[model samples]
Target: MSLTKIVPSKPIKLYCSIICPWAARTWIALTQANVEFEYIEIDLKNKPEWFLKEVNPGGKVPTLKYGDDYLIESAVTTEFVADLLPEAKLLPSDPFELAQSRLMADRFMEFVFPAFRKGLYQGDVAGLSAELFDGIEKFEPYLINAKPFFGGSDHPALAEILVAPFVSRLYLAIESGLVDSATSTKLATDPKYAYFNTWAKNLIASPGVVGTFDKTTNLEQIKERLAPK
Candidate 1:
């Protein structure tokens, strides 16, 4: 299947919250693609009237406005930006590889995050380790041959763009003792996870991930969100 490229006739604008990992995914994609887009920060707690009325009634961050039209959903917008700028090579050129990248990213979004949330909010360390280890193990195979990134891309690709936010938070969570220290040790030192560690380290340091994510602020916001309400 040929990759379809959509170049916008009008300027692009993205409304996102800095603390939102979902929004971070789209931000990374557009930034990595080197697209010139207006960055409009949304106050998620109190959304603007027009944003609620016209942009997205659902009031979700990462709402992308391409001229007069709008697109919501982080995953949709992330991939859309990659597809829009084919020259960036954000998605793989090969069909199967492209599918694999999307599949891995989707898996992370579906299983990994929910597991992390369940563990964090419920304070289930054992359950957290078990679920996280399982999810990480599943992700291992994809990176076994990675040259520090999915599909051996020198820069972050679609998979990295999608999963980087959560992975970065996972590391921070571990360092902050929110996640099990043993789990972090194993991920860092265990030979079984060497490939994943390499890929993760590289992903964290990549320009796109680094540019869009602020470790300290995001960690604090996450803790605040997870605090007893």
Candidate 2:
């Protein structure tokens, strides 16, 4: 799909942190849309006063400044950018397909991610990993058509953009031994999850997805954050 270049009247700036999945979502959307914008990295641990009071009162990363308007929330930011660049076709034109894409993203956030977080941070890694696998099972059938991405689109769709960051994190966790090996194996080799496994591999390798991903740094940060107190 061809992306339409948007020449903004004012400067566009994105406030983000490399380690933040939410920020990654917006970054991927912007990159996929081929939008030119300034990226400003934020230190989540020690956010500056201006960021807290002015940029985003809630002090969240992935805040977008379009001209003088500030936009918060990753999903909203991603959608806004996609809508702004219609020629990108980041989202499907068909209403049913678009709703399906949104539903898929919603499912990952609601079900898969919480399980991943619990497995990573709360202990019982084995049990939680199983739960995570179960959550993944819910979406495996969606990829049964041999499409490289969700919804059978050759290009990364809205669903892929929203979920790829977390999916990449899951791979990092598996490789780092934070998640159980058995769970990882099931995701990789089991027939039930074969489609999802293939989809994940392609998504991770996509330029927009990998461009914003720093696996080494992200893995180390995850290890640090999940370490025992």
TM-score of each: 0.88, 0.91
lDDT of each residue in 64-157, candidate 1, tens digit only: 9988899999889988898788878897888988888777777776667765676555655567678876777776655534686777677888
- List, residue by residue over 126-145, the lDDT tens digit for candidate 2: 65676776788775544334
Pairs in steric clash, model 1 = none
TM-score of 2: 0.91
Cα RMSDs, all models: 4.1, 2.2
Q: Please give me the total number of clashing residue pairs in predicted model 1.
A: 0
Worst 10 residues of 1 by lDDT: 1-10
Q: Who wins the lDDT comparison?
A: 2
| Cand. 1 Cα-lDDT | 0.79
